[model samples]
Target: QKEVEQDPGPLSVPEGAIVSLNCTYSNSAFQYFMWYRQYSRKGPELLMYTYSSGNKEDGRFTAQVDKSSKYISLFIRDSQPSDSATYLCALELSGGGADGLTFGKGTHLIIQP
Candidate 1:
């Protein structure tokens, strides 16, 4: 079973709003992070990935991690309607394997125009 917690929200926001998505995990071994964006009926597309406690930026998206607090966050700047989708937070142990990968239930987001 997954051990991550994320608010399963149909979180609504107007276009151009700044959106913040977060997740928390209890496992301290998790060192690799991934944030995915899933459209209505498509597979999740990896939005961000990181391996340390800091912030990583990609265009309008930012992914952050704080190991001490076991916290993960994804920030979307200048949010647009096309950003309406579900966001999934995933974590993995330090090794390069799939066995330790875990994911949160995901938060549904709606960017209203």
Candidate 2:
């Protein structure tokens, strides 16, 4: 299996709706979990990062990690058309160095009007 897998969803969601994006990993040594948002051809911007299993919230975004199940999720509470973009999940192994982040293909999300 791939180290990380995410649904490349062109998930069409109405504005103001909640959005959920998820990823699954096969490596247990991954200790850093991160979610990123990217628009068009721009590089992804880090939305949230969690060191281990637990939940981290920031504004309209919440990131949840479950090491036991090798799964991670990002929840967007207030969806908007401006929020339309691709969501990517990243992981860095325990012994990873400064540039060890591994990324998934990314899920395409669109918040319609």
Q: Which number leads on lDDT?
A: 2
Candidate 1 is scored at a TM of 0.94
Candidate 2: deviation at residue 62, Å?
A: 0.3
TM-score per prediction, in order, is 0.94, 0.95
Span of ten consecutive residues with least summed lDDT in model 1: 93-102
Clashing pairs in 1: none
Across 1-113, the per-residue lDDT of candidate 1 in tens digits comes to 34799999989999999999999999888889999999989998999989999999999999999999999999999999999999999888875675656889999999999
Candidate 2 global TM-score: 0.95
| Prediction-by-prediction clash tally | 0, 0
lDDT of 2 by residue, 65-107 (tens): 9999999999999898999999999999864466679999899
lDDT of each: 0.92, 0.93
